[model samples]
Structure formats: structure tokens, C-alpha cells
Target: MDKKKTLLTLSAVAIGSVIYNYLKPVKSDVEVIQDFDLQKYLGKWYEIARFDFFWEKNLKNVTAEYSMNEDGSVKVKNEGVNITTEKTKTSIGKAKYAGNVNEGALKVSFFGPFYSGYNIVMIDSDYQDALIFGDNLDYIWILSRTKSINEDRKAHYLKYAKDCGYDLSKLKWTVQEG
Candidate 1:
């Protein structure tokens, strides 16, 4: 019985350590964009570049549509087509403007019962392009309304991302075609 208890304790400790490490906060160099104009920021945004993840890998023609909800939250609808499978997936979520509009931060909830932080780190004056950052600073995205971005524009955004302490080399440009 004593041996069993010791084994259980060690197992629990190991599990706890793994969880802590996974949830450990990441240092962010990206500055939250304050004073963002929601009206200008609204509308459809196409994903140009993003960090590759299991759910979104090999996805193309991805876009996010945003509109104001009745409760003053922003409705987020993300859609994409899987190049390999030729299947489409859409995820619906809601985002509430956190604090004042000047903060440029929003709380998004896709899990229905829980909310996550979504901050706008950089945006163009015309709202043509934007760089979005999430909690832990690991999830970053560069978005535009069109399928492609100009060379100069892409370079500019990359530089800004680097300035924000992002691992630019890890960025995966979303393949627009199969």
C-alpha cells in the first residue's frame, strides 16, 4: 500500500509539471494597439500568413468575417478550405470589446463557456491589413482583404512582427492554391 501511494504521488507530480509547463506564460514583445477604430476594422479579412497548427494546416482561401452582435459583441466567423481534402470548415465565435474602444483588445469565446484574449497589435490606417496577436503571444496572424499582398507591404509587416519579438522564421505563408 505504501509503494502504491508513492507511485501515485509521483505520477500526480509529473502530470502537474507538464500542465504547468504547457500553460506557462510567454513573454510578448507585441504591443497592444490602442485607440483602434472598430468601424474601420470591421468587415472581412483574408488570412495571408499564420503559424501552422494542426486544425489549420494545409488550409487555403481562409477568411474571417466580423460583425457587431446584438449584445455589443463582435461575431466572428472563420472559414477555410482544406486544400488536400477539398473540405470546408467554419468556426463561429463571439468577441466582446474589452474595456474602452481605445484599448483595441477584445475577449473572444469560441468554446461557448470560456473567453480568450485577442488583441490587435498592428493595423493599417485604411484597415486594409492588420496583424493580430493572442494570449501567450504565440498565435499571430497577418491578414488582408485580398488573396495576395504586395511585396513591400509583406516586408513591412514582417519587419513589424520581428520588432514585436515574434519568431518570423516560423511563420508559414498560407498556400493560396492547391
Candidate 2:
């Protein structure tokens, strides 16, 4: 009886350890890119992949469009197709540089006056695609101008994210209609 009790306690500890590791946020040293050009970054970006979020549930063919507004803030329009419901969903938001313009840090809000972090940690030259990270490691998205991504680029981003301590098992490869 004592042996069985010991075995059960050990098993519980092991399971708890795994869950704790998964839930704990990755303390990243990853900084947003320097010399960030908000104007150049403004354009349509497809959701190549992302971590699941309630607002984006059942979404496919997701895309985010950015453009400059007269007030020097950015206008954001997010669109996605809900194939499950056979309907299109759209949300409009706005963004402004949260820090220095040279830093790839911005605050975006779809709701009135309430904003959230929208930082671009990794982006290639020519702005073809980018990796968007949130204030914490919980939120992440791989965005590209094109709907499809080459394996090479995808591999690079995956490795980088892993190195930054993200759990790759949680990544959801987004589905988009060509």
C-alpha cells in the first residue's frame, strides 16, 4: 500500500512539472528590430501561423492591413474567413509607436483607448515577412505578404523562436485560401 502511494505521488509531481514548464512564460532577451520603418511596414500581411486566441477562433484566410492615418497613427484592418460559419469577420484597429520610432514596438487597440502590445521582433530586409511578438511570450504570429510561405523561411523562424524559448508544439499553422 505504501509503495502504491509513493508511485502515485511521484507521478503527480512529474505531471505538475510538465504543466508548470508549459505555462510559464519564456523570459526572452529578444528585442524588437532597430531602425524600424513603420511606413515601409504598412501593408497587407497574411497570418502564416500563430498561437490560438479566442478572437481568432475558427478563423482562416486571416490578413491584417495597415496604412497611415492623418493623425500619424496607423489604421489597422483585420479580416478573416470563418469557414465553420461560412462568413467573413473583420475588425478595425489603430496603432502608434509605443516607444521610439526606431524601435519595433507599438500599441494597438481595437477597443476605445485600450491598447495592447504589437511588437515586431524579427523582420527581413525589404519587409517581405515578419515575426510579431506580444509583451509576453504567450502571443506570437508569423506574418507574410503572401499567403504561402517557403519551407526555408518557415524553418528559420521556427528555429529562432525555439532559441528564444518558445514551445513549438503550441504553434498553429494558419490555413488560408489561395
For lDDT, the strongest prediction is: 2
lDDT of each: 0.80, 0.87
Provide C-alpha RMSD values for all models, in order.
6.2, 10.8
lDDT of 1: 0.80
The TM-scores of all predictions, comma-separated, are: 0.81, 0.82
lDDT of model 2 at position 109: 86
lDDT assessment of candidate 2? 0.87
Q: Which has the greatest TM-score? A: 2
Q: What local lDDT score does residue 82 receive in model 2, on the 0 to 100 scale? A: 89
Error of 2 at 34 (Å): 0.8
TM-score of 2: 0.82
- Lowest lDDT block of 10, candidate 2: 20-29
